[model samples]
Target: MNMNRTVLYKAALPIVMVLICAPYKVNAYNIEDAIKAVQLNNNGIKASKENVNIAKTERAQAYTTLLPSINLSNANTRTTYDVPQVLPNSSSGDRRSTSLEVYQALFEGGASLFRIDAAKHHLKAVQSDHQSQVQEIVFKAMEAYERLVVIKTVYDFHVKNEEAMQQHLNGVEARFKVGEATVTEVAQARASFEIAKANKNVSSGEITALEASYESITGEKAPQNMDPVDISGVYIPSSLDELMQICLKDNASIVALSSSIESARGNTRVAYSGLAPKVIGAINVNATNIKRNSPYKQDGTTYMIKVNMPLFNQGGIEYVKIKEAKHRERKQKAALESQKSAIISAAVGIWTKYSSSHSTIASMAEAVKASEIALKGTIEESKVGTKTITDVLEAETKHLDTKIKHTQAIQEQLLAVFQMHQIMGTNLSMFTNTRPIVQTAFNKS
Candidate 1:
């Protein structure tokens, strides 16, 4: 029974120890925070939101064309008649009129229907534009957040290196007093320590600036030491063709450009409709009264229906020159194609950088392992006076340098990978725990 217990203890001890020494993990920033920091805070999103409201109001106005428009007016007039200038029963005539007139659209060569169609498309375009703004702000905020993490990591490493160099300088000074090291060695150590200090100061300043910029973008204080992503495994694209397809379908830039093109097309149709004839059926009731101070009065009322249509337009040349109507349509289509091409190019570049950075990180990892071994050997030899203080310092410097380089390479690789995912317009939920905010700006309309 004792032997069995011992075997069990031996088996579990290694596992327990590994668990205790594991690096502390942290939660990633959620997408909700990003949405609040970006979509809510961004000026572009605010403008787009207003545009959505305007589009909805415009659509409501267009619908009114199908209904009757009514107007009410009241007026009073008094005039003294000229002496017989023309059969003046214009007897110091006083007149008062009150009337209401209304018109209902019955038909107009399909123009009204086309206008309604155009308005609906215009509203859809506005909605798409608003979403585009939200996406853009989210992207910018994420980039700034990631950049801040990289800066903080690099700054922390520099601080550690400075402390390590200071310790080496102190040891070298002690050795010099003991006649084991020369003043020249002490001076060299001091100089290296100073340079390390300078580098640390520069890193600290850079971190401060980056933190400020990050705060500005988020409209909130930057979180301390956010957990950096631990990316592993090389990305192997299925094929370039697949990537192209993804961009064509999911790229927000292209989607926005296409929306613009559709909106422009609708506007062009509306402009051309102006050349067509318009007709409306109408009925109006009106009454006028003429009064005399001696208590005489005259009154009349009338009811009528009327229709009006355009016969000729002298403005055809000007209408044809409304370049905006056509240019906007063509420009948006061209821009959509250009955006797709640019996204494809960017994805290819990011993938290549990810590949190169992956290899660099691997090579630096090996270098760090070698340096660690060398550092250990030099420290063991230093106690026996075989390894001089300068030699130990050199080995320490090289080891620290390799460690920093390795960390940097890791950071670059993670950023490149994220960038590639960004280009593909992957869902934010994949990397974050929170979801995007609900947009209800046009819910009522």
Candidate 2:
């Protein structure tokens, strides 16, 4: 008992240590997060995993095609009538006998090898498809994450503007009550205030919708006050050709298509592999008892070996080869077309936006600077009775518009960067490299 206890303890110690030493980690699973959740949880991936298991089982089954098969039989007979012998009348004798038979495959038309190879190729195809599905999910997550970030930033901007406008309105209302301001100015301030509030509501709704989509993909609630990405320092490709090259090399769709082409080629190999002859050998043992309706007695044993060759298959094999070849051709063509389309679309969209947004940003920055100077001049002139209250209000409004536009320009640039990244799969590494700020926030408690 003591020895058994010691053995059990020794057996369990390693398992306990392994469990304790495992890594404890969590991720925000945002746009930057690895899209493992989607792949790990997606129904498609589950099916792919099952297909891999099925392939293994099929390989085992294929091996059995060469193994020997056995059969056993026993029978008892009793004669009730006499039979005539060669010399005179004679009685028939009762007899009981048991026979064992075995058959083994000695050769085949390479059917087993073809079956195994086909199953293996299918397994590889499913694995490639699983990887493709993973890439697709990651792209989707990136899209959702970026949309949420855009909405949050825009909403915050509107909320800040609303607060500032509310304060200005309050001040203007007090001045009007003291006969220091016109009713028209007060009404104008009120109108601007209402517009800001409406914009804030709309932006907030957009944020909520984006948040819901993010959560649905991740199966987790998002953190509050999630900060937008800081892509100000991201490198932009210089030209359309440069962008196209990167996308061709990195795009998930392109990668998936490439993998599929390989898989189709593998299928073609499997189909043609059937043309080769198969050789196999097997041993079998069969036993039977010479007892009537009894399971207690020992029996005789027999062994056998056999071989089979296919001369004609009624065109079944030929049909399969032709079908596989055609399917492979179709897959190859489809992959080529898909890669071409993705590259062209990414190149045009990113290049056009990259150029336009850069110009817009420069122009917006200048406009904001000019608006600042104009607002200051208008305020000075109004104090000296050279400008009316309307002129000052108009200047302030223009400055605000320019500031907002500049913010929008920055947003457009960030969005453009994300779009470029989507075209290039390597951009996902940015999310992988950057640690979420919320990690420390949560750890502090």
Candidate 3:
């Protein structure tokens, strides 16, 4: 029994060791995961959320202006001298009193209503600003993600180019020993190999910087493996006009500015309200002791109506305020137009880049293929003494350059598509499969 148990243990030991020593497989982190992390952990997004909350509180405060104000008061007093009798039996040095009052504004020349309207619009503007902040963060995350992918590709190509150059140099050196290759050929091959190494090092540095940026934005370390962003199915407008129209209507910046303009107009109306009268209605109930230490009491109810009209001020401040508000309204209107023009210009530039990247990518891809074939042919001809080492190295350099360009073009196109969606105020959730934080916050608020 002991011998049989030993044999089983020996067989199981290898399996156990293998399980413990093998590297665990990590899942590939994708663009969706990165964006989700940003939404959950980014400090800027949290701050923007607080701003939205503040705006909501302000709106609620404005609504309270329309509600009646109620007050309850109680007072006790003692005096050194005896009180003079005002009522038939009232002669008290000490007295106690209580009162309850309710007051409501009957009219305020629409100023209160205008202030409420302004608050509502201001809340909307804040919400839109929050959305803009979210979209900006999302775009930056996507850009960083794509940049890492492209740099990795380029780095890999550079490594391959280095290896190929090394091999070519070895071949040239061997031929020089046999007097079949000149010293210049070997020197050229060495230079090309060193250049490839330097290119690889530069790419490595860029990757490190980009990873740090990714962590800063997402509040997490970048994954060792990241899945490439796939933008093939992302929608693009059929025409520039369509894109411009969409941006003017839905872009967060544009929406925020439009709301601000409305808020400014409301403020102008409020300022103008200073020219009209204000009417207030109030009801009061009171009870008071008529005599010190006496059970006898006096009770009364009062109704009052007050109207206030501003005939003039020391400096005509009301008129000055109206003028100031009108100037502010005009400023907002000008800002709105400026924002529209900027958005249109930005949209056109992004569209132009998106449209051109397709052709660029196709052309670069073809160039890569041609340069690859040419390198192979040049290498073969060099071996047969029909091509110099310089020709072969040049072909290798062209091939590497083309491959790098092709990779960059692909990443640029992907980034542009995402930028387009961002500017259009469309939800990135359609692509990310996660609900947008902006929408979630709005719903909660």
Best by lDDT: 3
Candidate 3 lDDT score at position 30: 84
lDDT of 2 by residue, 1-445 (tens): 9999999999999999999998976543344442555545556557656766776686688668666666666677665544455536554445566665555555444555555555555555555555455555555665666667666666777787788678768877998999977999898888878988998899888877877877676555556544456654555666678778767765655665665565556556556645555544443333433332344455444343433344567767755785867687587768668777967786798778878998899999999999999988987997777986667667766877787788777777766666676666543434432542121111224
Q: What stretches of model 3 exceed 4 Å from their correct place?
A: 1-25, 82-92, 293-295, 433-445
Which tens-of-lDDT digit does each residue in 274-384 have in candidate 1? 655656665556677777655455444444445555555675553763466888778878887888889889878876787689689889999999999999899889889
Which residue pairs of candidate 2 clash?
106-306, 110-278
TM-score of each: 0.78, 0.68, 0.88
Worst 10 residues of 3 by lDDT: 435-444
Q: Candidate 3 residues 45-149, lDDT tens each?
A: 999999999999998998998999999999988755443575545444666899999999999999889999999999999999999999998788878888988
Q: How many clashes (backbone atoms < 3 Å, residues ≥3 apart in a chain or on different chains) does model 1 have?
A: 0
Candidates ranked by TM-score: 3, 1, 2
RMSD of 2: 11.9
Comparing 1 with 3 on TM-score, the higher-scoring candidate is 3
Instruction: Kindly provide the TM-score of model 2 when superposed on the true structure, using C-alpha atoms.
Output: 0.68
**Cα TM-score of candidate 1:** 0.78
lDDT of 3 at 199: 87
Candidate 2 colliding pairs, count: 2
